[model samples]
Target: MYENCLKGHSALVTGSARRLGRAVALELARAGADVIIHCNSSKAEAEAVKKEAIALGVDATVLSADFSVDGGAEGLIEAAFEVAPDLNLLVNSASVFPSNRLAEVTLGDINSNVLVNAWAPFVLSRSFAARAKSGSIVNMLDSRITDFDHSHAAYHMSKHMLALLTRLSAMEFAPSVAVNGVAPGLVLPPVDMDAKGGAADAQYLAGMASGLPLKKHGEPEDVAKAVLFLLASSFITGQIIYVDGGRHIRGGE
Candidate 1:
């Protein structure tokens, strides 16, 4: 369905070295777009993804930057433009997921979460909108933004603000660029998750999905497909597509 829609288009995907970010980057390359894969410390994995993209006959570049600092997001954007000045798509998929209950959360935790998950996407979106010829931006959000996750209070709040930013940016950058978000539920857990933690998260997500009409957990590609739709659709903007196996409809059931 995305054939030739992205031909000759250039895309920059932040935190795209592995997992969902890598999946999205490869998917875009498969659809005929040159890709800039951004990573923090996954240089080898990023290069692997780049090789895969090159095998698909698309130009690929790997960029490394820590998006958790004050100026990291802008620096990433500037680096991307330096590689491909006429960039057409930006994917804000890089994020920091720290687990801390509200009672124990510190100012440092809150600031770090907000900077990486919320503010970085906002700054990168604004930067892309200003320089893009005709561009689209997809922000990676979490379904937990709607339902409270007590263990990840700060992270949840940061994603909540990102959802708002997606809407407001859609209005602010309208008629020039399209801004939208994809909120994925239980696609992939953090790399550091232990067996117990992974199983617990999986069970929780499965329980949530059981009440949904789809009755299944989602995959990263499911989210990527929704993103490709947004990029291809000429009229869609300022929207949040939940690729969560309909879990959002359960309303925390």
Candidate 2:
């Protein structure tokens, strides 16, 4: 269904090295968008994703920047424009998820989390609005932002900030650019987990999924598809699609 939906469009997907970001990049390529794959320290993996997108017949290249560093977001945007001047789409998917409770979280933890997770996206969105004559942006958010995540306090706070930015940006960049977000629930395993999906982590995720309305989990492509839907639409703006299997609304029950 996504075939050629984004013809003539060019996108820069942050964190495209692996996981959900990788999935979104591939899906965009399948839909016929030239893509710029951004990675921090995953250049090798990003190269692989670039190859995959090129194999799909889309112009693909890899850009690297550490979002945790100052000016990283701005630098990446400048570099992307240098590579794809017609670039009109931005996917702010790169984020840091350091686990710590609010009571125990350090100031450094808060700074790092907010800088990478929230500030970076904010900068990218601003840069895109200024450069891209017209296009759209998809910010990757978390379903947990609707509530609290005591176990990941700083990360949760940053996501809340990003959610607010999504709405404000949609309003700020309206008519010229559409800004939206996708909040995914139990999709892929945590980045810290074993790449091969260990049994213990599988059981843990299963237990978590059992309580969701869907009583199951989702895949990275599920979130990627929702992103593509937003990117392909002309009327959607300032909206957050919960690709969370009803987890965000579970409290209502």
Candidate 3:
């Protein structure tokens, strides 16, 4: 579907060393965009992704930035522009997914989550919008922002703010650039669960999928395709596409 729409375009995908971020970066490269893959610590994985992108016949580079600290977002964007001076697309896919009940959440947890999940995206979007000749931005959000995930209060609240940032940046950027978001549900479990070989987590996700209107769990590819649509649709902006197996309509699961 992308075809030559993204040919010669340059994109930056934050937290792109692995998981959904890596998936999105590779998809963009396959669609003909040169990619800059940013990671905080996964240098080896980032290089592997870079090789994959290069195999697609597009320029690919890896950059590392710790978005939890001050000036990290600016440095990431700067590094992207250094790789491709005419950068035109940015995906704010890096985030902190900390699960904690309200009573147990510490101030440090709240600050770190907000800084990485909400503040980094907003700051990066603002920086890109300011200097972009003509570009589009897509923010990665969670479906839980619409419904509450009690155990993940801090993460959900930060994403809720990010959803708002997506809309506001769309308006703020205006005719020069477009801003949008993709709110995904159950595409992949949290990294911790994935690491533990947690069959129960998989079962729970499958059960949730059965409840969805689509009767299936989504994959990163679903969100990637939606992102390509937004990037190509010149008339669309300030929109949030829920690639969540219609779970948003069901209110959860």
In order, candidate lDDTs are 0.88, 0.92, 0.87
Please report how far candidate 2 places residue 78 from its true position, in Å.
Answer: 0.3
Error of 3 at 133 (Å): 0.9
Candidate 1 wrong stretches, greater than 4 Å: 190-192, 196-211
lDDT of 2 at 120: 95
Q: For candidate 3, what is the TM-score?
A: 0.95
Query: Which has the better lDDT: candidate 1, or candidate 2?
Result: 2
Best-performing candidate as measured by lDDT: 2
- RMSD to native for every prediction? 2.2, 1.7, 1.6
Across 80-103, the per-residue lDDT of candidate 3 in tens digits comes to 787898999999999987679888
- Please write out the lDDT profile of model 1 over residues 1-253, one tens digit for every residue: 6886799899999889988899999989989999999999999999999999999999999988887766888899999999999898999999888889999999998899999998999999999999997889999998877677887888988999999999999999999899999998867655545536667878866765567678877778988888888887789899999987765776652
The reply for model 2, stretches above 4 Å from the true place, is 194-201
Error of 2 at 241 (Å): 0.4
Q: Go through the candidates in order and give the clash count of each.
A: 0, 0, 0
Instruction: Name every residue pair that clashes in candidate 3.
Output: none
What digit string (tens of lDDT, one per residue) describes model 2 on residues 1-253?
6689999999999999999999999999999999999999999999999999999999999999998888899999999999999999999999988779888989899899999999999999998999899999999999998877778989998999999999999999998999999999988777755656678767877887898999998989999999999999999999999998889999422
